[model samples]
Each structure stands twice: as structure tokens, then as C-alpha cells.
Target: MRVEQGFQPTPYTEGNPFTTDPVLPNLLKRLLPRDVHEEVYGDLERFGLKVLTTLHDLTSKTSEPRVVQYDQWGRRIDDLQTSEGWRGLKAQMQEEGVIGIPFERKYGEFSRVYGFMKQFIAIGDSDVISCPFAMTDGTSRVLELVGSPAVKRDIFPRLTSRDPSLAFTAGQWMTERPGGSDVSQTETIARPVSNASSPYGPVYRIDGFKWFSSATDSDIAVALARTGPPESGSRGLSLFLIPLRRPLIRPVDAPRPPALTNNIKIHRLKNKFGTKILPTAELSLEGAEGYLLGEVNQGVKFITPVLNITRIHSALTSVGSIRKCLAIATAYSSVRAISGGRQLLKDNVLHVAELARAHLTYRALTHFVFGVVLLLGKTECKVATDDEVLRLRLLTPAVKAFAADKASGVMEECMTMLGGQGYMEESRIGTVLKDAMVEKIWEGTTTVLSLDMVRAAAKPGVLHASASTISNMHQWANTIVSSCPADLVHRLAERLATLRICVTEVISAYTNPSTPLLSRPTLALFAYTTSALYLLEHAIWAHESGEATANTDIEVFRRWIDEGGLLPALQDVRRVKTAGADRTKMDAEIVYGNTSTTQVVDDLPISARL
Candidate 1:
């Protein structure tokens, strides 16, 4: 319904969608700085293209559906050689060195490096790409090559420079175990192997097993083991450099097999639902020789920096999953038709509207997330104080958990929108759902992360640092509402104020030790709402500053609000059960669920599932 012939309008013209100057885009240039956040996001974005190309290649080559059956993964989740179908996939995996099947030269000589982008929905690491850590260890090096960088200085000259000729090769590792969230549990025993004729001088022997061993076939590995007893709860633990192959080297007169020389063995593969791309494995160390990283009993500390980085990257990965859901749901809504051959999209105006709404919401949410991280990365927070570290830790769990938890529902709703088609793999909604489901379990569960937030929430003499952030967002939301009935806006604002007070009171009451057991879930929900509002408020403000939501996005949101953004906005206010008004407005959003408002409000719309 855009105007082809109309009188030129002034600022905020209803007809001209691009009425506002894109000041925000320019503002982003000045305000934000060059940093890792931008770089990493860029990398992820590039990889996403790589993934899309990979998927496209897959689709083109498909004579039949790219089927993935559960049984193909062995009794253990990591095994993908169950039958002809799996073996076929395996050959394709090795041939492509990527996930998308019937593989072709998508990124020639690159082999579709981003094939596992959709694995975000996995419930566990046992998907196609079961072991991201295995391949990257969150680093671009195999653990073995990485573990003893200093010791391997002899061959450093050759490995020093990137190949001027070909694609950069990388490896993965799978060494995580069930019991170790913070540290490498010292279950495996390490002994300095003596009287052994091997290239590595004074090789140490390792015996025990590693669970969650991902990227087991990587170039190198860093396996942790306890040299002694329990007093070394974590103190006696040491990490070793287990390499896949010994780099060509001159013979050295020494006893004990030093580098990877057919000693360490992969025990089995884990079988699980989702993420069939990454490989998570299990391994047994039987007298495998090795070197150490950092210091003994210091494996846990050595891994912290790397672990945090991985968590952040994983957070982005989840964001990618969320994006996948949006794309799949949005596309499906357009094509799906209903009772009278009319598209479910246009036939049911609500669905079409809500899909548009949800797409914007997800984009904005992730954009804020990406923007924040980018801003933070531009600054030097490396040598931060204990307080700063605590803040980072506190925020870390929250971002990972919140993004992931919401993604689950978001993807599911997208899946639901497709009806029968979404249930199958042909549409990609299923993949979106699967990927979103896994985001919750990884890094930290929602509850686990929320607890961390609660623990870090109130500092001495402070109730809410984020409250001001929320207040600004409230002001902006109020702006949107102002365009509605003036009396209605006032009344609604009053109710919102009252609900905030009540919610705060309830939360304070809930925090008291005297609170009963029955209050837990209710309190948790309330706390979640409070926390989410704070986060959401920050998210919104990040854009309002003119750094984002300008240009195309602004028009998108404007169109959405003109339709029914207020309904969803009020719905959130109502979640705290503020006064309800304009049931008709609410119904349009509820029944249709197609606008950006719906996404920020609910994330997933019914059409996404179809």
C-alpha cells in the first residue's frame, strides 16, 4: 500500500517510509570503536554466508532428501557409521570436511566450513557438529599443538607462518568430561614414563579416560590428568599435549614416546539428539606420553580465559540459531495457505503481521546483543579488577542463558507456524527448533545462569544499576503509547507504575528466608520478568541512541507499531498484570502474531511453527 503518486511530505511523513535521516548509522561510526567485537561479529557473519552457500550447494545436489536418522549415530552418540545412510553421510563429511551433504564445491577448497551453523538447536553436543571445542577448542589450534607451544619451538619456524598457498587448516578436540564444569577433573593419572625408546625425551605416561572428548581427531590435544591423590582435588592435575601426528623432525636420542605415536586411543562416540555436525567423543589414555601447559594443578585457571571467550562465541552461535528460526518461519508464513487456498499469511492477516513483527524483534534483540559485545570489545577490559571480573562473569551467564532460553521458544513457535511442513526437515523450521533447544543446555542452563544473575544482582547499598536503563526504555515505550489515546496512556502508565512497585515488593518478599517453598516458581517467574525487563530495556536503548533501528529497520518498526505494537507492549506490561485495555488491539496481535511487536513481546508467532 505504498504511495506511488502522493504529495511530498515533511519529517515523519506517513507515506515516505525513509523519511528520517539515517543519523543513527553515522552515530554508530563515531560512538563505537574498532575492536574484537566487530571483528568476531564480522567473522561470524562471513561464516554465515559460508554456511548459506554450503546449504545451497546441498539443496542443488539433492536428488533426494538429505536424511538424518537417529540410529545412524551408533549406540554411543558420536558414532555416525550405523548403516548405509550414515556411512554415506560420513564419507560426505570427510569429503566435504563439513556438514551439508551430497557436498559440492560451495567455497571451493574450503569444503563448506560453515555447514554446522544450524546445529544451534541441538539439545547436546551429540549433533552433526557434536564437538565445536574439538575442532576449535574455541581456538584455531588443536590442543596438542597448543598445549606445548613453547616446547615445540623447534618446529615453530615451519608452523610460524600461514600458508600463502591454500586454505587455513584448523583442528578440534574433545576433552571435556561430565563432572568438570570449571576444571579438568583429575580422573586420568599421569606418570613420567621412563625406559621407553621414543622420540619425545622423558615422556610422561597418562592413564584414564576423558568424557565429552570432542574433535578427537584434531591436530593436537590437551588432556588433563592427576599425577597423584585427592589432596590434589585440582592441584595435582596437569594438561598434556597429545598430537595427532609428529611433525617431521630429526631423530633425538631419548626414551619414551613423546608426541602422538599411536598411543592415545578414542574409546567411543556419544549418541545424542541434534547438532549432528559437531563431533563429541570419548577417549581412553593408556600410557600416552605428554607435556604440560602453564603449570600443574593450574589447568583450571589456564582454561578460564579461553572458556569465557568460547562462552561468548557460543552466545553468538545461539544468536545465529535464533536468526535461523526467524528466517525459516518468515519464509514459511508467506508460502503456507489454508482452508480456501489463500495463504495462511495473507488469508489470516494476523499471521502475516506477526511474522513481520517477530522477525524485527529477533533482529533487534540480537542486534543489541551484538552491539553491546562489540562496544565492550573495543575497550580494554583484559586487566580488569575483581569487581569488573565479577561483572563480566555475572553478565556472561545471563547473556548465554537468556538468549538461549528464549531461542528455544522462538524456534518452537517458528516450527509450529509451519503446521505439518515445519515438522519435517524440508522447511528448515525443524532445524531451527532443534538448534534452539540445544542453546538452553549449553554453557549454562537458564536457571543456572539466572541464579548467577541473582547472586551478582544487588551490590552493597544498591538494588538496581539496570533500573535506570529500564526507566529510559519505559519512557520510550511511553512515547509509543502517547500516540494512542492520551487518557489511555496515562491510565496505562499508572497501572505499569503500580505493577512495577508490586513486582518489586513481591521480589523483595520472595528473597526473604521466611518465604515458603510454593513461592519459588512464582518468585522465579517474577524475578525472570524483572531481570528480562532490565535486559530488554538495555536492548531497546542501545538502538534508541541512533546507533541502530534507523533506516530500513525504523520503517519496519514504524509499520509494525502503526499496526499494533502497542498491544504487545501492553501485553508485557500486563504480564506484570498491569491494567488491560483495547482488547481488540491485543486480539489482532494475539490472533495474527506477525509484527516486530510480537517478537519483542513473545519471540515466536504461530505462523513460525507452520
Candidate 2:
């Protein structure tokens, strides 16, 4: 018997990301010094094509890491055996400086821009190895803030090494069973050791269970343990660096240290719906050696640096994944045959429209996330002004939450464009969707992040500063739009005005005690306004800078606005308080109804009732 094959999509071409997105190089050209941009761009191009593409292929073939608790001789040895493909890819990442780029600072002020652009591309092919990379980057940032001289001398170099043999990854162990994001309820206990033997100073013994440890096979971890009495909450907790294995340093010339237990026991791995390529495990630390970081009882404040870094990672993961999805969907639509003997790309107006919108979304999110990345780079380089610093603090949570949420919706639409095939495991659409969902939940949930935005806006001068920045961006956009088609420019101008009004209402709602219910909606409105401003700016730049596809870029901006991209919330300042009060009343009524009635009942034996 003979079998017939069906239509299949040609695989997406993997090459230099700089070439893939002309806008990226153009953005870099404007942001970085010419000499620095050229060098950084060249190196990243080579790494992206030669190293990242190969690793992406390898990652697709690798299985999840398996944990072996005992040796064949019945000796206790907790070993995490990962696939050759995973190991090979990890080695390549080290050699390519995927995790080292930002910390190394070889490219100067624009180092982070170059580094983040590389990360943005690498993540698409990263097989969720980016999970560990995110935590590792966060750990590095934390150490930079508080690590002792010895810790910095011995660990920072190894962490930032481009040589695989000497490099190490770090994990973040923060969550516990009883307390999810509420670190105030942390139950982990740390007892001081007067004369402990360790490279890091002020050693402590940790005893607690971590509910979620994403990178179980990592060399070291940053954890939180209560150094004060049980009632101390977040204030009583302290941050500690614990080596997963003793003698954490890996010297290139010497043989790797012998398998030494660190009293960190892996209870079980999480059977997650997505990111199966990364191993997330539950761990129990009993008498585990850890070195206290920073002053005792000041862990919460210090941990913010790490969280800030990881949150950016979460945003990158979101934007990168959606970009990949758009690429796949667009390519598949171009080739797949449909009605009237026409390809889906050419014949289907609805499909074409979907692709156009997805493209617009991808562009907007790219700018939003990258904008944050640039701010972070400036902050790190000590070149940022006070206003920029304040904007960075305000925008971080907003961008992370908004981008992650928007990516999920965009990916879903892209999946729908692929029809039934997108649902299959072999297509990997479902995998990306699941992974994107995790990004929304991790780092911080939408609700939690919205509250953070409220807090930031409430800070003195922050709201006004953000408003002024948006106004300046709008003026610049209007100047660039002057040369474009009149109707399109007018529409954009209208949207920009709505954005301004919405921002004012959002700030007002947040500040007023009676309008607590407006917090989430206000944050959403703020995000929409910010995203629209970014898209407008990108369109303006494309037109003025004579980018390769200026006309198409302008059209994307038009479509984005035409499709109701920047529509403000219906609840403005006038209605926010009323809506909030109504919501609270309804909620209370549900819990305890206004019509109260009571009835008494006599208990009966179970057998008699039956």
C-alpha cells in the first residue's frame, strides 16, 4: 500500500537575529556609539547563527533532567543526569557569553543593550534553559549588590566566564508551600555558625523546604531564611547564598570536585504543564551551609535587585516567544494551500489581517521591553538621570505584566491561524503557549504587579514625571508624523490625547482611597498608553531615519490604532469611586446577604438518615 503526504510548512530559517529584524540593528545604531555598535553587532551575529541555532536544535531533542537519589552500590548520592543535548547546549551558552554579556561589560554603556538583544534571540531557541539563565542573571545582580570581597573575587569571575569549564549557574529558592509570593510567611530557619569553614563569610545552617526551585541542578542558590524569631515576618528574614555542592568553584586545570553532598535533598520534581525542558524541583535543606548576604534582617530590601532583573527576564521571555510564534504562523500561512487554489497568505483576508496585527503587536512589545532594557543599561552604567531612574522603577513592573499578558493573547491568535496543526505537540505551538502562561504567573502576577504600579505612581513626583515624558514623546511623534498621510497622523494624534487623559484618570484613581477597584484597570490603561507611545515612536523613527521599510512600518502603526489598540478604559476618574463602591457592596452582599433569615435544625444519626 502507498501513503500520501499532506502539506507541511517549510521550517523557519535560523540565522543572525540582526539581519532577521532590521529594526534591531537600526535601534542599536541610534542607541550605541558607532564603534561599539559595530563590534557588538558583529559578535552577536556570529553567535546567533553559529551557536544559538545549533543549541536550539539540540534543545528540541533533549529530555527533562532525571534525578538519581542513590548509586548502584546503595550509597546516597543525589545526582541530576541531564541529556547530552542539554549539556552540550549549556556548554555552548557559556562559550557564547549568553549569560555573561551583561555582567562582563566588554561593550561599555551599550553592553546591556547588546547583551539583551542577544538574549532576546537566544531565548526563542533556548528550550527554556533561559529559565535557569534568568535566575542565574538575577543571582549575579544580587551578589554584585551585597556579596563579600571573597565571594565577589571567587564567584563573580566564574559566573561571568565565557569558558564552559569554569562557568557556573545559580538558582533562586524563594517560594515555600504555605507562602507563595507572601515572603512574610516564610518558615525557613537559619542558625548562625560561629566558626564555619567556607569561602563566603558569616556562615549559617539552613533548615527548611523550598516549594519551588526552578534550577535544581544549578551550582549555587540565593535563598531566604528567617534569622529572627518566627513572628518577624519579612523583616526578620535574611538572604543567604548556598552552594548546591561544596567547593563550588570549577577550575579549568583541576578535575571537578568530588561528589559532595550539601545536605540539600530533592524531594520530587514538579510535573509542570509547560517548560518540561527545564527541571523544577521541591527541595529540603537540612543543616545546609549558607553564607549570609548583606546585613542580617535586611533581606527583603536587598532581594529587590534580584527580583527586578528576573522580572525583565520574564518580559523578554514573553516578547521573544511571541516573536517566534508570529514567525511560524506567518511562514506557514505563506505556503499552506487553501480555497480557490490560492495560498492562505494571499487569498485569506482574515488570515492576512491576523498576521498584520500580530506583526504590529510584536513590534510594539519589542520596543516596550527593549525600552526597559535600555533604561536598565543606562542605570547600570551610572549615566541615567534621576528622571530616568524614576521611570525605570515605574515602568519595570508595568512592562513585565503588560507584555506577558499581551504575548499570551497574541500567541493564541497565531495558533488559531494555524488551525488544527497548531494544537499538535509536534508543532510546538502548545508548548510555547504553556511557557508564555508561566511567564504571566511567575516574577509577579498581573494583580500584584498592578499594585506595584499604583505604589510607584503614588511616589512623589513620579506620576508627573511619567506624564511629562509621555507628553514629550507625543510631541516628537507629531513632528515625525507631519510628513506621513494626514488622516493616519490625525488618528494617531487622537489616540495620543486619549492616552494622556487616561493616564491622568489612572493616577487620580490610584491616589483616591475610595477608588481601590480602579487599580487593575488603571494599570491596564497605563500599559496601553505606554505601548501606543512606543509604537508611535517606532513609526516616527522608521520614517525619519529612512529605515529599509519605512512605509510598511507606518502602515503597521495605522493598523494598530485602527484595530482599537489604544482604546482607553470606560471607567474614568468621575466613575471610578462609584464603581469601586458598588463592587464592594456586591461582594459583601454575596458573602452576607442583606435579607437575613435563620433556621434551626436537629442533628440525626447517619444510619437513620440513610
Candidate 3:
């Protein structure tokens, strides 16, 4: 709502105060389930051992520096050398729709690497553009439908079947010539063939040139095409499960022609700013034969499932990039001595405080992201109920918007702390910073997410108890502000107070059905503001508690709460809540034309009553 040219994106984080709630703690613990960790770690290890190792041999061994990830202008990678398979992957990621890493053919021999590739498909996309994780998750659901036990058996067919030469990867759908972000204007057309010889009676023929396709040379593509006429918009669009080897089904006996079937051809790749290894491509599909995956005119809907996961991955990618930045910033502050004789962070106690706080801020977001993933696991391909559907729609924007905002600040602060060296090539935060700059713009910009937040805000009582639980959270923050050192806490209290104002007003605004729809945007901002402070304030509360201060990245929860000038700043949030409640009561009174009620119970925000 307020833009400041002087604005510096700093993460003034705080701890959560609601650990007392058995449900939250249990949920959080479960959210970062040990099983999930084992799975993730397992996937990463297998990926490297199987896919990435082979990938290194294929690309760099083949002598392609361009595929190794260069600067926006073809300059050079600063430091923190690129990861395995990252270079070649980046080359095709920005332009081509699909890519295959660790290309090999064990066909029926080696299942280890082949087994790993499928997992890589799920996770590699996690850090992708537009949050490919969400897209994958969505696709995984469809896979379950089309990709059932029967299909998995038909495709992979063996658990230990490792084919060093058998390759499968997650292909990306990036370029939309009508415009990348503007999917409604797509010119790609998929027409059902008449009297076709394929098993499905007829194959849908696709014709269109895609620009900026990423993740090239892979098993399959989650492609978008217009099944109807051009003017039909998103509704006319449909999703097709276009496999690399067409004519050949059941995933065995490796086809001779591995090239993308029919009319698919690669154009030039674009050299861009960051995300280098992703492999940007310009592709032409002339009468490409593809199977229609979902209902006609509802392709976007089918893709929406994976799109959700993709957004979260995109958020996590930003998180990872920022993690790299924080590493440099803290390091620089620790080593670089400043005017006060000690390092910049030590020169002023305040600086040390901020440094610790930023560290925690990152951890807090990361933990929350993992929590979202757990939630995603529970969510299915199709939202069977309205509440579930609404939750997905609302949560998607919040994840994207909030993650991007924090990413920019995290990078900026990390760079600022680094000072001179930060600007240099060696610091490396600059690369992460520049890499992150585009995140907020692509995959639904910050402002775009804010609007989505507003839309989510319109759904009152969805969370049921989320708002109240969050409110109780503010009270915990108030305790920290009350107990912490005098001067700093006072300033923090003021900001907290405003945060409270923003929160309560939002809860009241949305809960009060009598309130007009025109005011929802402001209401939505209040909701987002609440979500921000809820985490921040809770972080502060956790630090003050000390008994269960997070030990590792989990400790970020503790570190954030200790950050200077944020504890008391959260006090304002409570005030906002109070005002919001009052506003709600007032609106109800006016709507019913009665001045008698002191509190509006039935119409209260879902979180309140719950």
C-alpha cells in the first residue's frame, strides 16, 4: 500500500508465541516429518549418484561452456561453483519445454539411476520458474489417474532396474509466444485428427512455436495448448501428456528416434540474466501428436494442481538463493571491521542484533515452506470440496507473494552488509541477489500475489481457527515487548502495534459480511499483514521462551524473535485487531439496522469462532 523509494527490504523478524498450542507444535513437528526428510535426502543423494554424475559426463565432458551457466551477458559465474547437471539443465530450461538429464538406456538393466530420475523430476522442478513443484504436484495427481500402479508398472516396471543409459527427466513448459505470463493469448492449437490410427481412436495434433521453454530433453512435457479457437481464452486451452517418444508406448524397448515426435524442432536459446542451467529454448511444434490429458477446454484446470506445487518450489528456490546470500552477508560482517573497531555487526550492538535477526528470518520462512509442502501432500489432484479448493486458491498467492517479498529483502540486506566486497565478484551474494531480483517479477509478481491475497481474504471462516490462533499469537509477542530491554522494545512495540491494527482490522473486515466487497483489497492487505506479523511475532515469542529455542535452521525461530526493534513493533498488530473487531460489530449493527449488539458472534471471522 505504501511505496518508499528509500525502502530497503530488511527482514525484521520475530518468533512465534503459539508453541503452547499442542496442535501447532505437533503439526509443525509433523510438518517437517522425519519421513519427509529421509525422502528428500534420499532423493538428493540418489539424484547425484545416479543422474547428476552421468549428467556431468555428458555436458562438461562434451565441452560446452555455454551450458555451464554464465552471467546475463555471457560474463562468468562469480563463485560457489554450479551444481551437477545445473549447467546443461539451465541452457535448455529458459527456452525449451522439456529436457532429459542423465540420458542413458539401461532399458531393463539398471533401475537405480532410472528410479532416481523420477524422484528428481518431482524435486528438481521444486526450484523452478512459476514454482514448477506445484506444477509437478499437480501433474503427479494426473499421473495417479493416468499414472496409476498399473501405469508405473508399465513404465518403470522395476524398482532395481537401473539403466545407466536409460534417461527420464521432468520437462518444463516455459515459452508462450503470445506472451510468457499471458497464457490466455496462446496461439498453439491442438486438433483431434479424423480417422487416426493411434490407440485412442485419434491423436490430438498440436501446431505452435513456443519461445522460452526450459528443462529440455526429458521424458515428458506438461504442455499447454489451445484446443479451441484463438478467441476462447484460458477456457479454450487444454493440457496434453506429450511423451518424447510418441509411437512407442509402455516405456520399454527404447525407440530409435528419441527426438520430440512429429513437428517439434529446437530454435535458438536465449542468453539471459540468471537461472542459467535451465536451458531456455525456442521450439516449433508442427502437427505434434499428443494425447489429451484432461477435459476439453479445461487444460488450465488440470495444470492448476501442479501449478500450486510449482509456486511453492519457486518460493523455496528464492529461499535457497537467499540462503546463499545470508551466508555471505553474515560472513562479511563477522570478518570486516568497521568504524567502531569491531566488525560491522559488532561495531554497534544493534547491527549484531539485526544480523542474528536476518538469519532467523530466513529459517522461519523455510520452515513455513516445508509446512506448506506437508499440507500439499494431503491435498489431492482434484479438490473434492469447496473449502479445499478455496484453501488452495488462497494459499497459492500468499506463498508466492510473501516468499518473493522476503527474498528481495534477504538479498538486499545480505549485499548491504557485505559492503565493498559484496559488490565484488568473490562475495557471491551479488549473484544470488541478481538471480533473485527476477523471481518477484516472474511467476506472478509480488503485487499480483497481494491481489490474490485479497481474493483469499474474501473467503471468511475458511481457516476456522486460524485467525484466532494467530491473534493469540500476537499476545505472545506483546509479552516479549513487555519483557525485553527498555529502549529497543519500545520502538519495536510501536511497529507491532501497527501490525496489530492491520491484523484485527482485516479479521473484522472479512468476518463482517455486512462490509461491502469494494473494500476487500484493503481487507486483503490486512490479512497479509497479519500473516507476516503472525510469523514474525511468533518468532519473537519463541525466542523469549528459550526452553525450546530452535537448535538449527529451526533455531531461526529463536534468532528472529531476538532481532532488535521488531518485538515491540509488533504491538501495533494487536491494536489493529481490536479496531477490526469493533469495525465488524459496527458493520453488523448497520446492516441489521440495530444499535443494540455489543459483539457480533454468528458473523464473526471463522478463525474467531473456531
Candidate 4:
């Protein structure tokens, strides 16, 4: 047999995603007791190995889920057939209490941090099964928030159950053809079902279509449906908990049905560009029975909890994916020979720099993501200060958007480092990149989330709290620099000052008429500035604790600041207006592509000129 010449695969590392690197665990040790860290780290290590197997199955393409819309008898069944690998993942997640940790209260206030960290570790190897887990976690949290006692009593245990057979995953069915992120345009309608009742409360018959239903195999869903007139917009909507399948177990003697008994009809499965193993469906709900959750017409407010949770999940997934890709690239670099027959790891200076930057990106994003997670933990435990809650609210979109934006770039760069081998489907690098692309699009696109950050910032007291937090970070940096190597201190100090100035400028720009284009840059500035501050804190921690890798951590921070890592592209107002005008014209020209900007500009008042 002719073997492929000059190819060597990197051996898999067998251990914990967290414990192997003491950075994350060490960072947590600053807050938790040593014993607590050890216990949490050990638990993650054991389960991480199993999760690694799931990753292997996913990368090897052995767990692609398929939709079977009809039975062999040509009757509608609308069943989802997933692979054994997928089943194993679901079972392991449930058994491991992956979705239940925060609610379990075993770890008390730190539980949310623990839960989210476990998710962050598991996501790299989770085959994106974390999708359903996110929804399940969010759904459970929403139920708790809305005070749906009966629903909680009946569904909460199953949502958090350790038994796979009993555990139920949930879907967030909010997207529709008319509204993707603007949930105010929701078209799904909920009509009162006369004399009907559910575990939650009064029953409603749901009717309409959901355009993008993720985790379609879930047992139940939390959805938004209009209970008021169509003109009521988001205010008219009501939240509902709809079981995909009736809860009653069918008797063995019961007659077999030709089609699924539930009213949810799977119209088609989306042929997605990535996440091929998870089934996502476009569904029609024709008279599907549901129980109203929360007060009528407060669906948006009720579902806010779920959105926050899912957004955090999305951020974690981005970081996790980037981490895994970087790991693969690092491993391959050690073994693969590059240009001039040199070991890629040893002889390539630029390659080494790229790798170093990737590592830097990973370290920085870890802090940013986990900072939010820690805040989330505090808020959930009702121990968070007002400032912390405000920070969490402001940072959620920033972290999610920023991580996703950087994560895709990280994967692409890592894949490029793999060269020819990276393009191969079997290399799994492409798959990682493909899957990561959706992250920025889902949860919310960067532009959408940037605008969200602006809205969040505009809220009363948010900007002031944010300013205080950044100031506190600056003080922390100053303290760290007081003791660290002298060569780096001045530069770090300068960068910190730059960060403060940039933040202040952006804040001012938010209200300035001439700087109406500050939305995107301001959000980017917020994310990058905060992330740098977090990186500085971690660096200080590593140094103060005398970790062996403290110098390496310090250098990453040094490079980040020296390389203009904290500086954002701040355009002058004149240029911004010019660009705005150009864009407005271009947008007018393009019904499809390019049209006439003259018509648009001609109609505008002088004061309203682009």
C-alpha cells in the first residue's frame, strides 16, 4: 500500500482542558479556596476526556444528524435521527449536570461561574451540542425568573436532571421570517384555548410559523407569540412554554399514529453551512398547545433572561472554538515541516509571532468572557452590587460581539498556519472555522450588538458605572507596573492612559451630532479597552503569585499594548460625515447593487443632509 509521504498526525493530549494549564484555575484560585479549585478542576478533567471523544466523533464526521420527514409507510413522522455520538454527548451532558450546575446551588454563589466555565471547557469538544444545552439552561432560568411555579415544579427537574432519559432540552423559538433580531415584529399568534390548562397556567393555542428553530429535537420550547392585536408590536406579545411532545407516556397497547401527535409541523431543515450535526428546522405551529408564561404582553421582558444566558453561551462557545483551533495549530506546528524543510515550530519567526498573538488573543478573551461569567454568577446569587449588574448588562453584548469577531479571525489565521493540510476536510480546521462563522451571525451580528451596546450604554447610570470600572482597572494596572519589570511599565501606563482617553472620547461622541457614526467604534473601543484591562489583571495575578509562566503572561500583555492592541480606529468627524454620505448614496443606488444616489440626496432637507 502506498502511504501518504511526509505526513504525521499530532497525538491527542489526554487530560483536563483546565487543569493542564494552570492559568484559568490559578485565576479562579484568587477568588476560591484551594480545595474548591482542586475539586472543580478535577471534576472538569475527568469529564473533559470524555468530551474529547465527542469532539473526535464530530471532527471525524460520524455524528451528522438527519431529518426523516416521513416514515417508510409514507406517513408524516417528522423525526430527527441523530448519531450515536450525538446521543452519547447528550447523555454525558445530562449525567454530568452540565445544564443544572447553577440551579443546583452545590457551589453556592460561585456556581454560575463554575457552570459557565465547565461549558467553556466542554464547548471545544461538545460538537456544538452546547447549542441545546444553552437553550435548556436559558429556559430553566426564564422559568425561574417568571415565577412559573407549576411549570418549574413539572419541568425544572427534567431540565436539570442527571438522568439522560429524564432530562429534557429546550428550544428558544423566537426567530421568524419577518423578525430576526427585531423581535418586536413577531408574527406568531397565541389564542386562548377555552377551559384548557397546563403545568404553567392558562393554556393557549399557538398558531404561526417559526423561521429558524434551533435544537429542533428538543422536548419543549419557550416561545413568544402575539396575544394582542397585530399593531401592538412587541408589547402585544406573550411568552409560552410549549411541549413539543405531549408529556404523557403512551401505553404499549395504544394504537400507533401515522404522524406525530403534536401540532408542530417540520416544514424543512435548514441546510446550514456549519453545525451539520445539530438539526435546525423551519416549523409551523398550527394549533399547538402552550401554557402562557409571565404576565400577558410582557413576553419580551420575560425572555430577556434567556437572551442574556444564551448570549453568554455564545461568547463562551467563541472562545472555546478559538482555543481548540489554536491548540490544533500548535500541535501541528510541532510536527509538521514547512518551507525549506524546516520544522514550522522552530524556524519560522513570523509563524511564531502569529502563534504568539493567537495565544495572546486566547488569554485576553478568556478573561473578558469569564469576567462577565463571574458577574453573572453574582447577579444570579443576588449578591451582586448595582454596579456589577450594570457592568454585566453593558458587557454582555460587547463580550459576545467582540469574542465572535476575533474568534473567526483566530481560526482562519490558525488554519492558514496549517497551510495545505488546513484546507483538507479531514484536517478539521476548516470545520472549526466554518462552525465559528455562524457565531458572529447568531446571538447577534456585530453591528446589531454594537448598536445594542450603545443602547445599553445610554441607559441611566450605565456609562458612569462603566467609567468607574475602567478607572479601577487603571489603578490595578498602576499597582502591577509598580513591581513588574521596568522596561514594560511606562508603555503599559501609556496604553492605559490611551484607553482612558479613547473611552472618554467615545462617550462624548455618542451624543455629538457630528459623530453620529461612533456606534461601532465605541463598542469596539469598549470591548478592547476592558479586555486589555482584564489581561493586565491576570498578568499581575500571575506575577504576584510567582507562577512559572508569569513572564510569558507578562510578555503577552506587553506585546498586546505595544502592538496597538488597545487602540481603536478613531476617524475624524469630517471623514466620518464623508463616509456616511458615501454610504447613504451607495445604499440608495443599490436596490440590488448600484442605483442613483441623486434621488435620495435631492429629497433630504439641508439640516438632514448626509
Model 4, span 429-501: residue lDDT tens? 7777787778898888989987888788666666633533543233333454455555546546776566556
Q: Tens-digit lDDT track for model 3 on 357-472?
A: 67655655555454444344335423234443554455566666666777777677777776666687545566556656666766677565655555665554443236334333
Task: lDDT for model 1, please.
Answer: 0.44
Q: Where is model 1 more than 4 Å wrong at Cα? A: 1-50, 58-186, 193-203, 247-262, 337-339, 342-347, 353-368, 375-389, 447-610
Which of the numbered candidates is closest to the native, going by highest TM-score? 2
For each candidate, give its TM-score against the true structure. Answer: 0.58, 0.89, 0.62, 0.88
lDDT tens digits, residues 1-610, model 1? 4685654322111111011112222323333344522432344444334344443344333221121223354422222223333223323334333322102223332211222322322212122333343234233322323444444443322222222121111232324454544343456777776666333333677777777654443445555677657566667675555554444243434322322354555555566465544444566666766665556666555554445545554565666565655566655555556665544564587787666566554544454344334322322223343343444544455556656655666667777776766688856556546645666676556655555445554442122325333322233334433343443334345434443553454435324423122232333333233333333333234345454443444344343233323234334433533324555466778888758765665656668745
Instruction: Name the candidate, 2 or 4, with the larger TM-score value.
Output: 2
The TM-score of predicted model 1 comes to: 0.58
Q: How far off is residue 364 in model 1, in Å?
A: 6.3
* Residue 447 shift from truth in candidate 2, angstroms: 1.0
**Comparing 2 and 3 by TM-score, which wins?**
2
- Name the runs in model 3 displaced over 4 angstroms: 1-138, 146-167, 172-175, 197-202, 245-260, 335-350, 381-389, 454-501, 507-610
Give the Cα lDDT of each candidate.
0.44, 0.76, 0.50, 0.76
